[model samples]
Target chain A: EAGVAQSPRYKIIEKRQSVAFWCNPISGHATLYWYQQILGQGPKLLIQFQNNGVVDDSQLPKDRFSAERLKGVDSTLKIQPAKLEDSAVYLCASSSTGGGGETQYFGPGTRLLVL
Target chain B: AQSVSQHNHHVILSEAASLELGCNYSYGGTVNLFWYVQYPGQHLQLLLKYFSGDPLVKGIKGFEAEFIKSKFSFNLRKPSVQWSDTAEYFCAVNAFRGNTPLVFGKGTRLSVIA
Candidate 1:
């Protein structure tokens, strides 16, 4: 089976501009997630969805960032008025279930560079 | 809030040398631990995971990790390392209850010189 897929392997935007990233998860996967990884840091969870329903998004920046997993197969994460601090690798992952130990498959992340 | 910590930021060793990377988390309740590896120009992949049972868990590519519940630690190890083993390793944790997202530690970059 194919792994998770993401669009625009790299992106560049100016500060205060808006950017959006897309993710298409593995087939039959029930859970999808969006994470932000700054340089030299681990991936930080931005939002998680279990079949079109948000499971957790407490860490998401409500003022600037938003994500949606409509129809439970694909997802999109958007950041408006992007700041320099928002420059990072946007990773998307998918899993089969919500249970622990379920392996999560990741995509080749979209590396964003905000100038 | 749950958090994961990786002690080493970077490490370098000759091929065939032993390898060990330390990871610790701050959480009182039960957890699921995982070690992920990201090779250069590649996406992240699961090296191994520990949910319950044996403390020592073996993964692909001769990688293994020992989970210590009392110490709240999970350290990845390899008996003999190769140049291909050079990659960034990340430690992550997820709580058993609720809809807690997986918490990841700052990764360790390993360089194995031939």
Candidate 2:
């Protein structure tokens, strides 16, 4: 079985530019999540989707960040008009279910640098 | 709000030395604790986890953590560490029973010198 997959292991964008990251969860997984990990900090949850429907996005910055899981399998996270503070590692993770002790499998993550 | 805290930002030790890393969480409700290790150039992998039952949980690579409910602490430990054990260790917590986001610590970088 393949693990969660993400594209563009690294990205560099100028300030005010736009960037997008993609993720594909493991087969049969129902929960997908997007997290932002700033340097010297832990991963912070940005959004979560359960079968194409959002379960939580309270921490997401609506003005510049957006994410969608259209088919409930693959997901896309976008940042429009990026800012210098947006530089961080975008990590995508997925779990097989919504139960206790559910281990989340993470992708390699896409490191972004905004100049 | 739930949050995780790892006090040790970095630690160094010689080969065969014992290791202990401190971790704590804010919420008092039901929780599932986990420790993840990220080797150089590698993605994060589960070191171990604690849900219910035995507070002392053992994980792969000879790592172990003890969950103290009263103290609200879960600390990672290893005996006779090797240089291979050098990596960034993260402590995370899922406060709710299901489908809840994990709150992670800043992580502790362990440097085991041979």
Candidate 3:
């Protein structure tokens, strides 16, 4: 089966600029997630969607970050007025269900460099 | 909030050496443990997971992990290391209830020399 897909493997923008990353989960996966992985750190959850509704997003920096999975298959993460701290690899993952033990398949990720 | 800790930031080993990476999580309730590996220029991939039934779970590529509930630890192990095993390994945890997202550790970078 094909894996999850992400666009524009890399991006560079100045601080305060706006940027967006896109993700397309594997066919039939019901759960999708977005994570931010900074240099030397592990992936941190930004948001999670079960179908079109959000399941968790407590860690998201709502002041500048937003994500939507409107048709239940694809997702977009936006960082408005980006900051230097926002420079990280944005990863997307999906699983067949919302179960905690379910295996999540990840995309190659979008590497963003906010200057 | 749940949190994960990986003891080693980096490790260097020779081929055919043994490997063990320590990971611990802080959470009072039941949880599901996972170890994900990212090779150079590759996306994160599951090395193994532990839910229940067994404390020791074997995964792909001769990797395995032992989940010790008493210690809140799930350490990854490989009996014999290879250069191909060099990568970044992350430990993550999520509530067993299935509503929470995985909390990840800082990750450990392993370098295996031939």
Task: Indicate which candidate wins on lDDT.
Answer: 3
Model-by-model DockQ, in order: 0.71, 0.71, 0.87
List model 1 lDDT by residue over B28-99, tens digit each.
799999999999999999999998899999999999999988899999999999999999999999986555
Task: Report model 3's chain A TM-score.
Answer: 0.99
TM-score of chain B of 3: 0.98
DockQ winner, 2 or 3: 3
Per-residue C-alpha lDDT of model 2 across residues B7-59, encoded as one tens digit per residue? 99999999999999999998968999999998998878889999989999999
Model 2 chain B — which ten-residue stretch has the worst lDDT? Answer: B94-103
**Runs in model 1 lying further than 4 Å from the true structure:** none
- Report the candidate with higher lDDT, 2 versus 3: 3
Error of 3 at A108 (Å): 0.5
Candidate 2's displacement at residue B31, Å, is 0.6
Candidate 3 residues lying further than 4 Å off, grouped into runs, are none
Model 2: per-residue Cα lDDT over A1-115, one tens digit each: 9988999999999999999999999999999999999999889999989989999999999999999999888999999989999999999999987565888889999999999
